[model samples]
Target: MEKIILIGDSGHAKVIEDCIRSQGGSVIAKLDDRYQERFYEEHLIKGPIALIDDLLIDDVKIVISIGSNHIRKSIVERLNIADEKYATIIHNRAIVCNSVKVDYGTVIMPGVIVNADASIGCHSIINSNSVIEHDCVVENFTHISPGAILTGNVKVGQGSHVGAGATVIPGIDIGSWTTIGAGSSVISNIESNVTAVGIPAKVIKREGL
Candidate 1:
């Protein structure tokens, strides 16, 4: 079994831990700068994020279990670990098609259905119960929150967050750093760095506006 070092100790980390276990991988240690306590009842609290610099041992993999897309991207950039050292975890319950491509540092949570020809970029999160349709492109550092549905050929840009239960119609393009609010029904293209919300999603605020 492969040994993994999980970087985060919150509720999100707990879910990632379970996904790793379900894949028959063992979590050797957990690192969190904020909470020094154990991850749960069984996993021990290893050390701080600073310890990552000293982890030069072979065969040990790392996974950023943080929920926030920005924070996860920052940590991954700071660590700069080798591509092979970063683990891509897909829960056993996920239904990923054979033609789907999941990049390194991405996590596909339980009940995720990634259809054919879908490309999920590095360090992205396909949260539990989400449905990513055929030919969809999810760029790096994006988070498709739980229960969100991306229809066929939908494009989610880098560093974006599609909130829980949101439904994006087919061929819609969501730009980078944009935030789609929970339960939104996105019909048209959403521009970069804005927050969109409504039955037919509309931009409520632009970044730094």
Candidate 2:
């Protein structure tokens, strides 16, 4: 089994850890400040983030357990981590098309259907049964919640989230850090950092729209 280091101790980190273990990867260490000597005793792990290079015992891959795209991108950039070596974490049951581009650190859950030419950004989550049509673009750190559907040529921005069962029309552009509510229908463009809801997705938070 390959050794993997989880890079956080938050609740999301715990979930990622469980996911990793479920995939049959060994958790060599956790790279969080919150866990100190106590973590060592509890998990029998020896290293942390500060000692990342030191803990390379051959055939080890690092996974950023951060939920936010900004945080994940920032850490990866700061560490100068190579995209070539970074692991892309996909559940065994995900169905990705041959022509799709899935970046590193992205998590594709079960029942996801990414059609031809769809681009799933790094560290993004395509949740269960989400349907991404051909030529759709999902930027880094974005989450396509369960049962969401994006028509062809749709662009979902970085750090944005499309809630469960939402449907985005074809050729629409959704900006970064935005949130589309559950069961909403997006007929128009959604700007950055706004929270939109309802059919046709009106801007609820104007400051970021």
Candidate 3:
């Protein structure tokens, strides 16, 4: 069993810890800004989130439990976290097909259903209760928020954020750096660096340009 350190200590962090345990690994410690005092208390300890550079051990690996794409990327950049050493944390209850390809540094939360031939890119976040159908391609640095649903053959571009409870129809191509609002329904193709909102998911702005 490898000694692992999770990067967050929130409720999501706890869930990832449980998943790590179920994967036949041991969580040696956790680092977060929320629980400073509890981190020093024996087994379930905490530490600084930004101190990963100072705290990373030779045999230990780091797992990002944060659901936000921006926050996760920022922390990675600030701490200079290694992509090769980053761990993918998947919940035990997640129904991920064997044919699915999940890249490095990605996390599939509880109740997520990733069907066959789906490709989840590097450093992406597939939050809780999401369903990704077959042949769906989610690009790098993207965040599929909780309860989102992507139909078959849907392609979400790099650094995009599909908000919570949102639904993307089949064969839709969502461009890079786009943000789909919560509870929205994407019925058409969305372009890069834009924010899409409402039921039909209209483009509001060219985000991150």
Residue 78 lDDT (model 2): 71
Give me the candidate number with maximum TM-score.
1
Off by over 4 Å in 2: 14-24, 41-48, 207-209
* 63-138: candidate 1 lDDT, tens digit per residue: 9999888899889888887888999999999999999999998999999999999999998999999999999999
In order, candidate lDDTs are: 0.92, 0.81, 0.85
- The residue-by-residue lDDT of candidate 2 on 111-136, one tens digit each, is 78889999988878787789999999
Off by over 4 Å in 1: 35-45
Tell me how far the alpha carbon of residue 144 in candidate 1 is from the true structure, in angstroms, after superposition.
0.6
lDDT of candidate 3 over 74-176, digit per residue (tens): 8778777567778887878899999999998787878899999999998888888999999999998899999999999999998899999999999999999
Residue 80: error of model 2 in Å? 2.7
- Residue 101 lDDT in candidate 2: 95
Q: Give Cα distance to truth, residue 57, candidate 1, Å.
A: 1.5
| TM-score, cand. 1 | 0.95
Q: Give Cα distance to truth, residue 206, candidate 1, Å.
A: 0.7
Instruction: Point out the worst 10-residue segment of candidate 2 by lDDT.
Output: 35-44
